[model samples]
Target: MRKFLLPLLFILLFIAESLFVQFLPGDFFGGNRILAPRFLFSALLLLTIFVGRKKGIIYAAIFGLIFDIVYIEIIGIYLFLFPFVAYVISKIMHVLQANIIVAYFVSILGIALLEIGVYEMDYLIHVTNLDFLDFLNLRLYPTLILNAAFLLIFIYPLKRYFEKYAEALRDE
Candidate 1:
């Protein structure tokens, strides 16, 4: 049960993200389009920061696979990118202090990386018609606002939980 608790939490975040996007009113963006929070992405980054890079990458890959399967038609985009983002952030965190502020920047960077990955994939397949500026103004900014708000609200508690879990694992 202990081994699976972290991943289970990730799955719940994924479900919450999906539900929030679906059920919440789109007026937050003042239009029909909604900026959904990236709950799993933020959770994975926290997992990496508190737990360890190796376990973080593993969980990222697992959740990324589920994300790709459930959310998008493209299979490899998130499956590959999510773990990649975890690996990059893990390296960056080694050089910088791991704290709430740093986590916010890293989460934003992760969100940017994810967006770029999706954009590149879509471009290759010619699925997206929006220009770069439009994509930035319309989608990226709103998404950053939404996900960053979530990170602000949840980061401390989630970090505490993962830190305690990591300490327990070390003692065992």
Candidate 2:
């Protein structure tokens, strides 16, 4: 029940973030860009790592699948990429201490880089012959900053809630 609840709650939050991103006006914050859904994904990925690798992978895959379905992108890209990110993060979890804030920051930064790289590579290989700098300045930077800021603000409480929830699960 505990295992199920954590993931379920995470999924609910993910869906909420996705809907918000989809419906909200991008110009709400003085025209600065934001990838609201990606921030949730980063937080979810980091939390999953702290919980355990297998559990984290499961959460990432689920979130990625939902993200893929909703967003106007290649269908399987996020589903494939996000779980792989979680898996890599999980492998290195032992080397890092159990500091939630640090993990959130690191994860957000990594995700930002990953998102940019993936976008560039996809464009280069399949989408267009566009200038790389244009993409970076126009799209990637804004999304990265927004996602990272969201992670910084939300990581602590979400981590604490998940920790307590996991502990309760264990006690059962």
Stretches of model 1 off by over 4 angstroms after superposition = 32-34
Q: Write down the TM-score of every candidate.
A: 0.94, 0.80
Per-residue accuracy of model 1 over 51-163 as CA lDDT, tens digit each: 89998999889888988898888798889998999999999999989988888888888888888777778878998977787778778788888888988899999999999
Mind sharing the TM-score for model 2? 0.80
The number of the candidate with the highest lDDT is 1
TM-score (C-alpha) between model 1 and the true structure: 0.94
